[model samples]
Target: MSGCCGPAPDGRYSEIFDERFASSIARRYRRRGLTAPEGRIIEALSGLGLHGRSVLEVGGGVGELQLELLARGAAETVNLELSDAYEQQADELMRASGVDGRVTRIVGVDLAAASDADVARADYVLLHRVICCYPDFAGLLGAAADHARSAVVFSHPARNLFTRAVVAMSNARMAIVGHDYRGFVHSPEAMLGVLRAHGLALRTYERSKRWHIAVAVREPAGVRTAPAG
Candidate 1:
């Protein structure tokens, strides 16, 4: 929601992912842990041997996913956020989880528009439910792939009639409420095309009724085989 949510008068997009929103997400995470799609992402990344590797997560609200990855053996994680609203909740969660030293949250940084030098490269890049928030999926995914040394994993709304209609309704409601935030159902093929162009090949793809989990990895030299999931 970082790249998609428009800033308010105070220059923060606190209207959406406000303190209450962050606390709600944190409380839900503490009670229920990762969601289904989030679990699938962790399962995929686990197969890559997370021990000692680093992660970069975009729009990681409350830092739940990063905390889980850290528990699963990832060395360090960086979260690039657009709003400062989630910081307090993220900090409290980190402290409560005893992972205060491992996770780094950089607020107000938009990965889509950041330069190569502005962000650090990591072994894996994660974007869970983030693609739908950004209008320029290409720019966002391209930057994700560019920052990934091993794999780029993401989740997006499935391209189907029901999903498209739902997104349209959501956007309409946001407009009606005078919110600049909107949702999009970008073409999965086109999104994958953007990643593939950056030397990442589709490795594992999983689909649910509403979301698609796609994992694309950078293959070693001379490996021309494609992955089937």
Candidate 2:
């Protein structure tokens, strides 16, 4: 979640995404990755047939999802991040899991800017808390579905008045501070439309007070779901 309060006095908005304090964030990531939200994500994944499959997690800032996917028998996982800040800490966590070689992290790239080779299709693709970070929902999500061989799972802000106020406040503060970081409140129906257009079928849906997760799997062999506008 975007901090309830704006960035700290120390330009933490920028530094938080840089190496300056990545270790601290990484530590927090390690702790929180094992919590309820992540649990729900894993629960949704239980039926994805992830065993020995490949995974790609966009905006997987701290590698938590990748680690968990590996633990659940994913053969390999790629982390597509928008910053290089987590390089050291992310690598360290992988080393700790003894799966360092199987995790490929492409830092400094977002889906809109990533190459086909950079994102090479995987059995499962994840976008936890990532949709709200990037402004281009269509481009980003379209790319996600294109890169997913079997299914795509993602979490985004729930469209509600409370979330609207929080995003508004956060954006206003960031604007005043001259920071480029901003969050979005996109339509779930439209998002489902994008997934549907990709020929993916909605398989499951889960939500928390602030976030919602949608898991869509590719249509069965020889079948295709009609795309929705």
Candidate 3:
């Protein structure tokens, strides 16, 4: 999963995903492998053909999902992160897994605002637990779709009474702690619409108790080129 908090526009919220938080996340991955939601994402992407493909994961913490993709025969992966804290642990994990050469970590770059050169396109794009952290889902998902040549898969809190309450309480706690980070509950239908507007069609939708997993694939050439919206 991505870090617990969203990155501020100025990128000054590094403390939210600081070294301590990064380490804890890394340690958990080392001990427990992918989380349940993350496992679901991998399962969905695996069916889409990962062999020799490249992946770009936005806000990927410790690059665990990328590692899994590599193990499943991905050629390489680029991890874009807002906080630099995850780099150290991600590097250690990559090196320990003997895949350091196949991974690139780009830190402190907001994909929505990054230059084309900074945001490289890939065969598969992933955003595990990222949509909720970003308030502007359109900007984030648009950039993600622009960079994806084949597919985009993301997980977010399901829009419902239970998840809404969770987000509300989480935001309240952040406010109480003086954190600028916030959690959002964007509508799934609207989010999928963003992908369709970018020429990607929704292929799969799955849900657990709290999160919704969505997988969208790029439309074939000369087919579905116009935005339905």
In candidate 2, clashing pairs total: 0
In candidate 1, stretches whose alpha carbon ends up further than 4 angstroms from where it belongs are 1-13, 221-229
- For all candidates, what are the clash counts? 0, 0, 0
Error of 1 at 154 (Å): 0.2
* Candidate that would win on TM-score: 3
Residue-wise C-alpha lDDT for candidate 1, range 34-139, written one tens digit per residue: 8888888889999988999999999898999988899999999988877678888888888888987888777766787787767889999999988998899999
lDDT of 1 at 186: 98
In candidate 1, the residue pairs with backbone N, CA or C atoms under 3 Å apart (3 or more residues apart, or in different chains) clash, namely none
- Models 1 onward score TM values of 0.90, 0.87, 0.91
lDDT for residue 82 in candidate 3, whole number 0-100: 82
Query: Higher lDDT: candidate 1 or 3?
Result: 3
How does model 1 score by TM-score?
0.90
lDDT (0 to 1) per candidate:
0.84, 0.78, 0.85
lDDT of 3 by residue, 11-93 (tens): 43476778899999999999999998988888898999989999999988899999999999999998888877887799789
lDDT of 2 by residue, 1-229 (tens): 1111111222322444777567876787766656667778987786777788998888777687778778888888888766657677887888888888888876555666667855688988999888887788988888999899999999988999999899999899988977877888999998888988877898888878877999999887778776644
Clashes of 1: 0
Cα TM-score of candidate 2: 0.87
- What global local distance difference test value does model 2 have? 0.78
